[model samples]
Target: MLKHGLDPADRRRPDRLSDRELADRHQAMQGFLTVAGPQLDQLYNLVGLSGCNVLLTDAHGIVLDQRVSDGDAQQFRDWGLWQGADWSEAAQGTNGIGTCLAEGRALTIHRDEHFHTRNTAMSCMDAPIWGPDGRLLAALDVSSARADQTERYNRLISAQVASTARAIEAVFFRSSFPGARIVVASDDPSEQAMLLAVDRDDLAIGATRAARRALGLEREGAIRPRPAADLLGRQDDLHGFDRGERAAVIRALARAEGNVSQAARALGIGRATLYRRMARLGIGDEPARLSHD
Candidate 1:
């Protein structure tokens, strides 16, 4: 709070961006808003009955979209939780949306945890959303002013906020890599979403933040394409001539539909040589299904 130059006693309401300025900001984040809109609505439907409001903010902490019940809308607006509001830590002090963006993690700031005394009446749960390019994209937040909202309840809501943030990131990633195959980098459910986008040729063209970090990739910026099999530690054709030959044989066999003679012909090799290669490659003999043609 001291570094942010915020006074705990400061009770002035946070200022909102001018309508025109807010419109420009929205225009900048139009693509992200489109991808995140449905997720925000779902989050609201999940928690709205409990007097909570869902908010999606750009990286700078400007609320670009929100879902609030009509009955609670007025109160949220008065508290500066509406769209166009600036909740960056610099502007609003230590709060859920701002602090989450500041720390790049999920957190809950219950009553009295707020840097400003005026904000203590509200409880906030927030998570940072990472872009497909592995950069901070936005923040997902749920806030409630219900007197009965407890710390335990806030924890549950924060879990949902984090999950929704990851969902938005995944959707944004898929949208960014249209026509590419998405592969999960790890089977561990505990880690952040680790995903890779592979082109039709089996080269990985993109990766999520967790995937990039786990793979020692450049955190942000253009990702150099790499063989998906190589990255996944699989038997890659790029590894050696034997693997390349194996891949060629497998592809030819698939195309020939178990016809060994046809597969050998396609590989420009005799059936005997094809059998020898297959034996060395550990491929199962399918002679029973092999057609002379």
Candidate 2:
């Protein structure tokens, strides 16, 4: 703000959402609210006692939900921390919701760390809420009013808020695909905890954000349909089945109704190559036909 020739000393708050804007944001966040509802309520209760506020914001930083204690709502509102507030770092300038989105990690922004001097007395801790597909769905935050805020108290609240964020992520992935097997791949407890979703055959179909981070995947959708063993760090677990190259070919062949050419197209392999892999996998005599019918 200082560089823009605007004075942080002016301490201007962002605009509140109009009725239509609030409705649109709520409509867009319906799915996120479904998974995050329980956690949101729990966090609200937890922070209410501290005279703080809890907020849930969409990935774009739109305020989807904002809650304060029984008597504190109006006070927080006067400060511009309302249900329709746009708290993205761009809008609020280095506060919890916006900074969390920019960093993609959980942490606290205390007092003077805020971009505007107006926010200098407030402190906030925020954590990212993610979807089953590893996309950021929303952020959960607890903000302290300057009057009663303390550096030590802020640190404790930050950890507690992050725990709730993890729970929200778990709910998202579990609800997204209940039939899929969920597993923890890391032996180390300190590594970020995550769940890998596998098909009935134990092939990986998807993963939570922590699992992707553990595997050093920098992008979403990095986990493809492959043997879960690749991430389990255990090769022995893969030996029990005729999987992958063979199973993909078999499933393709079955889907093609025994037409080798059609199966080749489906599997993205040449007819001869498919035949060769099938033979190498010791299924050369396998009958190719429709079991589905």
Candidate 3:
């Protein structure tokens, strides 16, 4: 359960925060306030004109920064929206930030969908930000008037919030874990494998467990960080070598049931590479057995 307060509808209002609670939170957030600059601007621009109230919050749900169009900003602030406000369920009731943290999932809450009394007039979408180590770092939210929102709009807003959160996470990962090799994979499984910083010796790292499995690593323990050479098989045929570019290609082929062209596109590789790899790996031109059926 989330430690923050419950949704407004779930229970009666608790007494306001004690002085100590306020002081502790303020002290805990000094570092974040200092470093938040261009990223905030970027987020503002990303969602500024979308008729939504965008908010950045700490892991614990304290509102760190907010960006709404000039027209909406004043209204939102007048409604008690501002820095230092806590939107966690404990503070503002069952809303995007609190529920996302509680469930650890991207969420969409339309007006009246929120579990808190004060939030009934707003629709919100939120995504939880995760650090490279998979820690919950923060939550990004886009809230707006419920009258004009739809499921599709909610999805688009949530996607934007997720993207922004990921960008921030990437920056955070690069700065805090300078020596750690970082690999950013698309949430989409079919895209060609994009590998970053593969040459850094100290940052040597391998794909995630899922990526290793996709690459057909026989043993679980064999998936540790190693030279890129160790992972790629022979490079005799250009086509074959190209298909072997990344594990994502192999996974796409399997998922597509051996549809070469489809797999190639999903892996973000040329069709020729798929064919070449098929030949090199001894995979037949004809679809695999399952596809044949």
Which structure among the candidates has the greatest TM-score? 1
* Pairwise lDDT winner, candidates 1 and 2: 1
Q: Which ten residues in a row have the lowest lDDT in candidate 3?
A: 190-199
> Which tens-of-lDDT digit does each residue in 210-273 have in candidate 2?
8887776545855667778767876532254555556677667767877777877787878778
**What tens digits encode model 3's per-residue C-alpha lDDT throughout 1-293?**
24553445544432334567756765775554444446667767866776778777777776766777878877677555556666676566667887888787788877877766666777778887654344566778878874767788778778777766655655554554456555544446432222222433422353433334444543333234554544544344334345445344555767887777778777777888767766666665653342421
Model 2 / residue 38 / CA error / Å: 1.1
Q: Sort by lDDT, best first: what order?
A: 1, 2, 3
- lDDT of model 3, residue 202: 25
TM-score of every prediction relative to native: 0.85, 0.75, 0.58
Summed backbone clashes in each candidate are 0, 1, 7
* Model 2 vs truth, CA RMSD: 8.1
**Residue pairs in clash, model 3:** 5-89, 5-90, 7-94, 8-116, 190-266, 192-267, 240-277
lDDT of 2: 0.77
Model 1 over residues 202-244: C-alpha lDDT tens digits?
A: 7899999989999998899879999788888775333567766
Off by over 4 Å in 2: 2-6, 188-193, 216-218, 237-293
Q: lDDT values of the candidates?
A: 0.89, 0.77, 0.61
Q: Superpose all Cα atoms of candidate 3 onto the true structure and report the RMSD in Å to 1 decimal.
A: 12.4
